[model samples]
Target chain A: MRIARFDDDRMGVVASDDTVVDITDLLEQYDPLDAADLLPDLITHFDELKSELESRSASGGGKSLDDVDLHSPLARPTKIICMIGNYREGTDRPQQIMDIFFKSPEGISGDGDTVILPPHEASIFHHEAEIALVIGKESKDLSRDDAMDAIFGYTVFNDVSARGLGREGINSFLGKSFDTFAGFGPWISTPDEIGELYDQHITVHVDGELRQDYNTSDIERPIDELLAYISSITTLNPGDVICCGTNHQGLGAMQDGDVVVTSVSGIGSFTLNVRDSDARQWQRGVDEEMAARVRAQGQEAPAQGNGG
Target chain B: MRLVLTADDRIGVQTDNGFVDTSSVFDDIRFRTAKDRMPRVLAVFHERRSQLEELAQSGTAEPMPALQAPVPRPPKLIAAFGNYREGMDGDRQKQDLFLESPESVIGPGGTVVLPAHEATIFHHEAELALIVGKRAKDLPADESALDVLAGYSCGIDVSGRGMGRIGPSRIGKSFDTFTPLGPAIVTTDEIADPQKLQVTLTVNGEPRQNYSTDDMEYSVVEILSYVTGFMTLVPGDVLICGTNHQGLGAMQDGDQISMSIEGIGDLQVSVSDPHNRDWQRGIDEEMAARVRNRAGSR
Candidate 1:
């Protein structure tokens, strides 16, 4: 089943590619405290509501997808855990320690939303395409075997990044957390719906140009182990997102008016317009030079110096 | 007025005598909104401040419920990194900040479970934490910046040293139960001055961090302003002021850690490492010396 949020915080299940069946009425029973609590409430009560949602989807009477404004599937996940260096970036580098970082939950923007580039003196803004895991239930200290069951669904995420802004060329919260920096959705596809999680392709297109192209098979740490390690560090609450790290091979600058579409197979895609009032410019297209540098020297080598 | 949340997620006001459960205010039609009437703290804070104040003033007090973090689930947990001078004569350094996983928060009487990851040491960073009262962005560095503050609380930024030696420190700082905030949120109106407060932390009943907010390189107002310039802050979001590194030390297994800020109450939590790792007890003089040297030079 594909879950979605659209048009003024209304919850729905996407019945078809172009149709969203309204299940917002189904959630009236939960009576969420605030807008932020809506999604979590649905996730919490999903086991009871699942049958009704399926029936409504079968009946199928709702607005066309194009007629509605889509919101991020999860309204306000408490934390967005992002993996660091979880991908090999097409390199032969050894598996390093599995570590994670955070992006502000408020940084989330939905499908077709405008990503406002902060006016900070960032060297460049790049889009890292990856898939995001939506936690199914409250979890902590999860074993690798239990990790698979803890995942509710997967969504396409554009881990929008600001390159070379960290103090002393290191990553900082401010650099990756400007409003709209974390973009995901069209909708979330359940695990059964998104078959072969390890073999799906993730691609990114800026404006009309194809840039990033990678497969989940290249990910250094597989899904279960990654979730297990992160849960050991932090409790994974329902609706919390663990954005699987991206392949930096196709990473390049996203400037004003550029439309970035990040797509993960079976999960669908989300398009966001980049708005940089500063109008800063960089060489357009795939950043192969930096990608090759990462492939050769490793992910840390290219991150050493400030970017242009 | 001080606000507290019970273990069952009820909001209440903690006064001199006891806790006055205010979670029922939402049930009153007059306080109910067309949108939300849920018994959540953020909802109450956003919609029923005046009523909450009234309850704090005259409502009947009852025994406090099993306690929890005052802000059970903040939308954000932003912290200032290295924003304090080591001592009175210490040189001021540039302001830096980072975001910690809000999921890391545990309430008073909670335990800080050190993750199994290998680390040189885990240190407790006691600092003044401000509870944002409203939605704010692009705030300026002036007295008006304080207008956005709802209250203050004691925050312990449990940090893991040497885990991120080659990358960002966020990895080391974001382990579950790393941020312990609470006891209660002493409303801004109750605190005379935010800058002139004493911030201190002790482990196993021994003093480890003792300092004043006055030595901060960037004051609370400036930190709020600087942070808002980039990210929007909402009600119940915690903005922790940086800590003084003078008496910084290690936190380990079976250690009782207590932290307090003047005006706000005390927050005590225990540390337990499943790995049972051990580090030298008391102030880490080598780390303190490094902090002091940097304080003087930079």
Candidate 2:
């Protein structure tokens, strides 16, 4: 029951045999960018559509998965909320209230896409791998007991961050919202198939070297609690993603020409290439100003010890 | 030419005579076919600026109806934090920026419902809002940041001091109806100098905030240039150039707040208690249930 949007906005079902059964007809009325608006319809009619996809696959007119480009499973999410400092085991800092931040929808890049590093010389880009929850229905003030029901599926999210900018007071949103900073999904795995959401293992690798490996069980606030808190603040619409925070124990930076892979077991994985921005010369002054401000603020400079 | 979106989602253009339905005046086949797909208010303005301008001069005038947020549900709403020199938490050094929930936007004449949790010590921040016209990303040195703007409008950045003092400003500034925008979007061509406009806010007929945009630490171009340096800003995205700290104070329920920019028209809003509002009662009940359930489980 893996649903995906691939090459040229065609909707398809990934069969167990690693082939894609075209189900574009079922979603003819909606455009590729309107995938979020079509999510509830897909969920409500999942059974009928699943059977039809199976029949279509049986007729032997499917394509191999390798033949097409895979896009993000959920397109045009109204919001992408990321939990900050939700992991407690790795840090000795005092436990504070759970902080949530936002990343622009434009930052989202699909599987096999490239994440362009900010041209600023001041930026020290880092990768945070965590599990992401895709909303199935419009939700508000959801209770812990009902929070899990509101989730349609799970995907892996790479919360790419500019550590230098982020540490400079109240720039968390900007630091994590650069173009192509958010990389999620090969495809979405439904909640039922994920068995126990909190028990799954999450991992991140940079150029084949493991950078972070941890179990979701290590999360301080469970998935239900996070959902309840976020829902209480604002409405969560279909296709919206909630990225659970990552453990900072093995957190590090990414360099140009590096490939970062983030994976959640029993779900899926995706890789994104890192490239330097073309406007590096235009960014020099701003970067220098930011660095000078960081020095003026008199805060401890961000540790540059974790070079990849 | 000024454009507005009414309560019914109809588009209108304000001219010297009155407001006219844009569809009635601009009946081109291409425009009719592409209107819904554009997804952003700025897209329509960008594609058919000349046609719209010609129509604005000759279109039949009609009386205005209740207005909605000009660009309701913009893809992104980025606000400048402490960009003004007179503000209390002013960091005269560099511009601090933060993202606000687009859902917080409410049209002119809408009520700013004080969240039940922190009902006391609310503040009103009147500011100028820039509507981006094109897809701008990593703007080159030669391009002027102002060139990317489609128009300008007025917005109130309501803050709940209780919640805002705790940590990041997102939660405090993001309550529903916290952002009151509109009246009409004055085209960038209409304004002579956006940097020197007068910004003022009055609460219940008493003048509280009055300052010129000249007091801002960073000019509009500088702010937009810095923002585009990080993320892409598409048409219909909004940037609220921060508010002046002068005359900053608390607002209370039943206060009628009005924010006006020199060129753009005024945006009037009423503040109400959310605890007693019909829609908020449901949310409050759900929140109470969660609190009780959590306590019981513990």
Candidate 3:
């Protein structure tokens, strides 16, 4: 099944060309929270939603894909671990392979969303078009085959970066992790129908001319080997998104209004615009926590007082 | 006032009382991702840095309740000292201490629960907090200057005051609640001059110390510039500019702390019992179980 977060950032799955239906309604029909997990339970509930979508599609009572805004496929992942430089042509050193790094979940942006480009950022920002997977079950020390089985599906990711961010070398995590720096989506593809992850063709473009064009098979260490290497170092939680880095063709500076597209074979493409900057303006996430802690602290909250 | 937070397994928001309703707040920055409700929440302080603080002083402002504080353990927290002449009262010269290698840091509402060991006394140091909002390396531009500041909140450096002449005790400072923050973030727009704001700290209702941001050895901009030379700062990161001096003394269980910065707001927290199994009982039980298992196997 092709899974997506669409229709005003609500849950849905896309079928054929014209039909995009909210799985959340189907989720309400069965259990309130099951459809949100996006794995086992979400995959398991597909039969019910499919039958409903089929009926709804026949009646044309649901939303078409064009009607709503699309968000990055996952709501909030456990973690986002991107390899620093995994491309064959990135560098010539083996020890340099799999330089693991993290980006906060807040950086994710979706199709057609504007990705701000700050003039202060010096390094080239690249559109990394690579086959990436979403973990299904919690995994540790996964065997090569086990790692393959653990992949629930695949998606397109920009691995949006500041090329010069890491050159100074004291701390690259900051450079790679700016607010709204990452772009992914259209949808998540299930592993069953997708072919071997190592053979997909990835293409990158600026204004329609091909820039980065490479095959997954060209990856030096391969997916299974890379998984084995990564699993040895960190635990793999479900919903963790790891892009297998970008080929050198994905490099260069991107200015405002540049619509960069990254597409992986069999999955889909993700297009994002470069905005100037998106500074943080948050009240923090404290609704449920606020109520609970207030009662414990002997203070009463307003009826609608969970979130501030 | 309520400040929300989301983390690995939980989300929490602090209010006038304490931490409340943390379940749904995904540990994500609100304004950057939560746009639909930005203007409704106090996130205005984030987008319009200087004008709002000025407006508030001019008495032409909307009524927003006081927000708590917000310091979700940033990806990184780089701290600094110096500026306040009081900074020189410590054993080290204020000149040498201004650049004290980061000894320790704790997040808002996160604990700094002291172990019962005879380590030097652990105490709270409240300072004007600086949160970096963008990727700032060898950076410039003052107009873009305040752009890098994510938001400001009051935070304590929870230091083990007596651990002198030796490396600071990571354990002493790392206690769970030592670094508490998150009533909610005070955006730069809310405070026109973060330097002139007043800061005060109290324990169990007795005022322990007080000072102003104006006494600092270095300005917020200068300090951020100096630190950026050696480090690449990113969004959701923080720096606890050194705190005002207070005489060091022993801390006991159930000590209540109240701290605040003028317009940013105030926070109060208390010491509590640890949530782990009893130390000696846990060790004895494990040893006993191992011996019985060995006998049965034989």
Candidate 4:
């Protein structure tokens, strides 16, 4: 099922490519006082609510997808964890231990939102396209076998990064946390809708020009392994996001007035407008040199801590 | 005005007589300070200050319940790295800061669960935490960062050492229950000069970190301005001033930790390590010595 939030906190099930069945009334039973609490509450109780949602979706007659402004399906997630260097880009390097970092939850913007490049002296800003996991239940110390059960659905995330920000020892906090930097939407595609999370083609386009074209098969760590490792470190709450890191191959700079579209095969596509007030520029087109340089660096050393 | 959250997650005000459960008082207006409404704390703190004060003055006093972090689950929990000018020569290096998981936050009387991660040591950093009051970004040259202040509180930054020697130090700092903040949020009016405040930390009744915010390399305003340059800080966002590494020491299993700032009241928590990891009982002389030597060399 493809669940979407649109037009001022209204809940709906996308009935077709262009129509959304109103399920906002179905959520009234949850007794949420505010719109911010709606999505998480719905997600937590989705099991019992699934049958009704399916019926309403089948009963069909609702608004056109174009008449309403779509919002991020998950509102107010407590954590937004993003994996770092979890892809190999078809390189022959050895596997490095996995690592993850965080982006401010407030940085999340929905589909069709604007990515405002903050006024900072950044070398360049690049959009990293990756599939993100929306956790279904509170989880901790999850084994790889149980990790897949913790996932509610998947959405495409743009791990927008600011280049030349000196992320060496700082966990890339400032570089990846500008408001509207973590854009994901369109809607969430549940696991049932997306069979086999692997081998799906992930792609990104800037101004109608393809920039990122990679397959999830290039992912260095399997989805379950990534989920299990992160859960061991901290608790994952319902609606929390875990963005699978992207392959750097075909990465490039994003500038003012650029329309960037990101898509994953079964999940559908979402568009974001990039606006840089400073009007600073970088060499356009794919930064193949940087991509090759990153690939040439080989794999990072294995993680040292006993946390793994 | 002092702000607090009860164990039931209701908003309250600490009064001289007792406590005022502000949750019910503000319920008609639909004010919620529950953990679920954490993102809205700053907005409430900013927009309802005067009304909260009035409610505190008139409400029937009741004993406060178990406490929670005043600004629990801030949208951003940014902490300074090596920011104090005392034990470490902070000026010798560039200004740096890192983000900690909001899930790491535990309120007063909470237990700091030391993860089973292998580390050379676990350190306790006591610092004065500033809670942002308004939405701010790229604080203009004409404005004072202090104008954006909401209040202050005591914060304990529980850090794991030796894990991120080759990369980002956040992993060591981002473990669950690594940040303990609270007791109460003392409004800005209660603190005349944040830089003049004293910060101290004790582990199992032993003195560890004791210093004045005066030793900070950058003033509170400077840190706010610098941070706002990177991204927008909305109400209730926490920016913890870095600690003076002097008097910093190791924390181990079953240790009682207490952190106090001059005006913000005391924040006490216990440390629990499942692996029962042990480090030297006194100050971490090795790290202090390293910084001391580095400072002398510079």
Instruction: Residues A60-129, candidate 1: write the lDDT tens digits.
Output: 7678888989998987776788887578876777775666777877857889899998888877888988
| Model 3 Cα lDDT, one tens digit per residue, A119-226 | 444445545566777877667667887777767778888876654442121232444555567788878888755676677888877667666677776676667776
Which residue pairs come into collision in candidate 2? B87-B245
Candidate 4: list runs displaced more than 4 Å. A16-18, A59-61, A66-68, A166-168, A298-308, B8-10, B18-20, B29-33, B37-42, B58-65, B87-92, B141-144, B164-166, B292-298
TM-score of each: 0.90, 0.84, 0.50, 0.91
Better of 2 and 3 by TM-score: 2
Please write out the lDDT profile of model 4 over residues B116-191, one tens digit for every residue. Answer: 7777788888888988878888775333777787788998888886564234356677777888999888888888
Please give the TM-score that candidate 1 achieves against the real structure.
0.90
Off by over 4 Å in 3: A28-68, A75-78, A90-97, A121-123, A139-145, A165-167, A171-173, A225-236, A275-308, B1-298
Task: Assess candidate 3 and give its TM-score to the true structure.
Answer: 0.50
Off by over 4 Å in 2: A30-61, A90-95, A277-308, B24-41, B87-92, B140-143, B162-167, B276-298
lDDT of 1 at B289: 76
TM-score, candidate 2, is 0.84
Q: Retained native contacts per candidate, as fractions? A: 0.36, 0.24, 0.00, 0.20
For model 1 chain A, the run of ten residues with the poorest summed lDDT: A299-308
**Candidate 1 displacement at residue A135 in angstroms:** 0.8
User: Which prediction has the highest TM-score against the true structure?
Assistant: 4
Off by over 4 Å in 1: A55-62, A297-308, B6-10, B26-50, B61-66, B87-92, B164-168, B295-298
Question: Which tens-of-lDDT digit does each residue in A163-200 have in candidate 2?
Answer: 65622434436778888888898877777667787788
Per-candidate interface DockQ score: 0.35, 0.20, 0.03, 0.31
